[model samples]
Target: MLPEAKPGPARRLVDAIRYGNSVVLTLLAMLCALLVGAIMIVIADPPTRSAMGYFFSSPWDTFTRGWHAISAGYVALFEGSVFNPDSLYSNGHTPIFGPISNTLLNAAPLILGGLAVGVAFRAGLFNIGVQGQLIMGAICAGYVGFAFRLPPLLHLLAALLAGVIGGAVWGGIAGWLKARTGAHEVISTIMMNYLALGLLNYLLGISGFQAPGSNQAISRSVHGTARLPHLLGPNLSLHLGIVIALLAALGCWWLLTRSTLGFSLRAVGANPSAARTAGMKIERSYVVVMLISGGLAGLVGCSQILGTNHALTGDIDAGFGFDAITVALLGQASPRGTIFAGLLFGAFRAGGVVMVANTGIPADVVLVIEAVIVLFLAAPALIRAIFRLRESRGGGVGVGQLAKGWNA
Candidate 1:
């Protein structure tokens, strides 16, 4: 018998993608994004560009300068996000945990926002109103934080509760609309975001919410008693918001994996018609899940107002709600995955600042890297094709399936 023909490179590549490992694909995607970022860094560095002009005359110089530029930018990123031994003694002081502190501080709100989206995802809902929910929460929390005169602990608790309630109410509106009117959540939530923005702007211009005699659309500072306390020393900006975020993640994990409500929600997500046939309350689940989702998002507002900003502004959400969508997607709609994804983005944020200062690279480079990462992750097929990864044998959960649960 004739020997079997061997597979060509193209056939092998296609077969590899058909059986690719998701974890490997994700890592490879990140590496590719960084490689693209490194190319941008080299192009943007003046010395590196100049060295390249003399490549024929001095190839070694060009390569050395290019490597140095890339190394410096990445080193600064690490020092800014994680740690820097060189900072052990600056101005005759002890080592400051500024880098890690900044990373945590930046991550806290992201974690909450991501959990909000993740919870909604697990319940067969697409919550695009995280920005609106967060804004409303901030408005309510900021009002309570400044207008009230309760004692320290009471004031903080009241403010936090107010924020949670505000977000829940806003989210519930969309759920109600979907249940009662059969309206699409994606459309309703988007409209609510605009409404929330307008409401914030209006509130900031009012007497009670605006800072005393301030012309800008900024709310009064939250009372000191209501603000989240610093987790480390006064020198560090890190606060108890990180603790709250952690607890929220833990709660989400328990709720999804160990609770009856979680089972009901997951069942509904898996098949609404079947769940309804089995006597599950579909409308109630929608409303309840959205309420929970919005409440978690409200925690983001509290972290901003009570921990980081201490004041409410029209831009209080700072695009975090939208970013949370990316986070939820990257995390595969899992609570544990969301936590790690939030930290990764937080590191990007904290490190980007230092990278800019140290390497003179444009801040846009970081944004590009982030966008590229999301693009690759969202299109796992592209990752598989690029890396020539082998496909697995059995059917598995896919990103498209995760995203298209409700709509698809």
Candidate 2:
């Protein structure tokens, strides 16, 4: 028998490249965003522009000064979001885990919000009203947290359940409209957001929800019994919400990959007409998927109110809903990917403040980075063309696929 031929170094290199293609593309996109941000920084700074005037005459000086400014900004971002080695010895009172804790706290809601969008994407639904759903959830959860008197653990559970139910009902309305009246979810969801904002404004004026002796639009604080316990200590902001977010991510993964209903949802998303021909209940799937998606979104409110904020305010939603759409796309609509994407975005959010305070870089720069990332992700073909990369074995999903799913 002839000996089996071993794979050569070139063949192994090709396989590795193919296997990590998506990750490589994503990293490259991030690099492009950073480069753009650096250019913006230079343009915004008068000193940097003056130094660049002598690019050819004094190349070393120009390069060193420009690089120094860019590095300082990124270093501040890193220290604020991840860790600052200087903090270890510079301040005896500084908590070693403080920065990481804040990052986790910020990421918790993003994970839940991203899952909401991801779940809807899997079912051919566009749940743009996640903002409204989140608001409703916070209202319901906040009411339960302050009004009800119960055992500690049970009270917390009750408040969370109330939030979930509120979000489900809100989402179900859009699904029902889509199924019965042929209303597009996008339009219905947008309308619902306006309605929710109006309702929130009205409700805040009521004595029942408003804080005692306060003219502000904030609701009463949640009771201690209903509050999510801190995983770290009172000094740190990190709470049990991170644990819940991780569990929810795992649940979403199981639902999408293992459950029969998930299969039905995917089939409908791929082709509603074919799904209907196969005897699958497309309309019901829409309602079910939206309900679940909204419930997931509602958890963002829980994280904010019960875990972090502990009070309901007009701005409680914190843009998590819209940011989630980008997170979902960056994650490619996968639960695991959503978690990583959420963390990355969370880091940017946490770091932006430090970058601004220490390096004088505007916080809006982070927003620009996020927008650029979305631009690149939305056009994978452009990235491939620029990089001159060969197509991977499974190829890639694009905005076209997402659009087709919506139509289906």
Q: Identify the candidate with maximal lDDT.
A: 1
Clashing pairs in 2: none
Q: What lDDT does model 1 reach?
A: 0.87
| Structure candidate 1, residue pairs in collision | 16-389, 16-390, 18-391, 19-390, 19-391, 19-392, 20-390, 20-391
lDDT, each prediction: 0.87, 0.86
Off by over 4 Å in 2: 1-13, 16-20, 53-60, 404-408
lDDT of 2 by residue, 92-202 (tens): 587788778888888999999999988888888888988999888888998999999999999999999999988888988898888888899999998998888789888
Output the lDDT of residue 47, model 1.
91
On a 0 to 1 TM-score scale, where does candidate 1 land against the true structure? 0.91
| Clashes in predicted model 1 | 8
Off by over 4 Å in 1: 1-20, 91-95, 404-408
